[model samples]
Target: MPKKRGKKYTEAAKKVEAALAANGDGGLAPEEACKIVKATSTSKFDATVEAHIRLGVDPRHAEQMVRGSVVLPNGTGKKVRVAVFATGDKVREAQDAG
Candidate 1:
């Protein structure tokens, strides 16, 4: 068996292990995992959860590579502005918006 950790570390580890076991052998679905993460979080402020995906494409091969951009249905939390170059009405609209 491994040596015992400090009190805080031991408590944190127990919470993590309990969370994992609560999900069971077949494993938790994405939504279930998110719930468990939220429930187990100790932060005072709201925490954002993210998932990382690894694709099976080889970066060395140009044909196997994928590149694209997507606009989220709900925009990012940060504020953004668009710049336009035009004459007359369009310019007036852009200036007013800016």
Candidate 2:
């Protein structure tokens, strides 16, 4: 069984649907989506943003497995420096990404 949502959730869902319709198939820009989310927020506590991705891969097959990571633009509150060690092609790829 699934839990029922409250009025706030329903309103936010409607706003999301409207934004999707206005943006058409291309979808909303990252900035626009953020604006909509912030505007529709009804909770007093801080809200979190996340992503759910689907890919074609078999977990049992090592060669076909996929893995990746992303860095948040707002960052974690602490300040820190990051380091990466790579060899050959990866070194070049990291440099290019930088």
Candidate 3:
């Protein structure tokens, strides 16, 4: 059986839906959406945010794959986690460098 959503989860979903409805344009500003995400997050860890855009390409066709990134002149302030994978003395170097 699938797990059921809790009261808090249900309330958060409803809140987000209402907020979206209030935006008659059917779109939320990036800042406003971020606020809602932060407000409705009940996890102990930081919430993960993802955005989807349609490019009108069939993903099943490898030739139509789209992948690239544009770095902003001013870096985003989001925290990033780095991993140091080494099997030998390099591990010690990573720790010392940190």
Report the number of the highest-TM-score candidate: 3
Error of 2 at 66 (Å): 12
Candidate 1 displacement at residue 92 in angstroms: 4.0
Q: C-alpha displacement of 68 in model 2, angstroms?
A: 10
Model 3, 1-98: lDDT tens digits are 97899999999999899999999876787888888999998999866689754567997999998889999786898877779998799999989988
Against the correct fold, how does model 3 do in TM-score?
0.50
Q: If the candidates were sorted by their lDDT against the true structure, best first, what order would they fall in?
A: 3, 2, 1
Estimate the TM-score of every prediction.
0.47, 0.48, 0.50
Top-lDDT structure, candidate number: 3
Which residue ranges in model 3 land beyond 4 Å of their true spot?
A: 1-4, 53-98
Rank candidates, TM-score, best first. Answer: 3, 2, 1
Q: CA RMSD for every model? A: 4.9, 10.7, 9.0
The 0-to-1 C-alpha lDDT of every candidate, in the order given, reads: 0.75, 0.83, 0.87
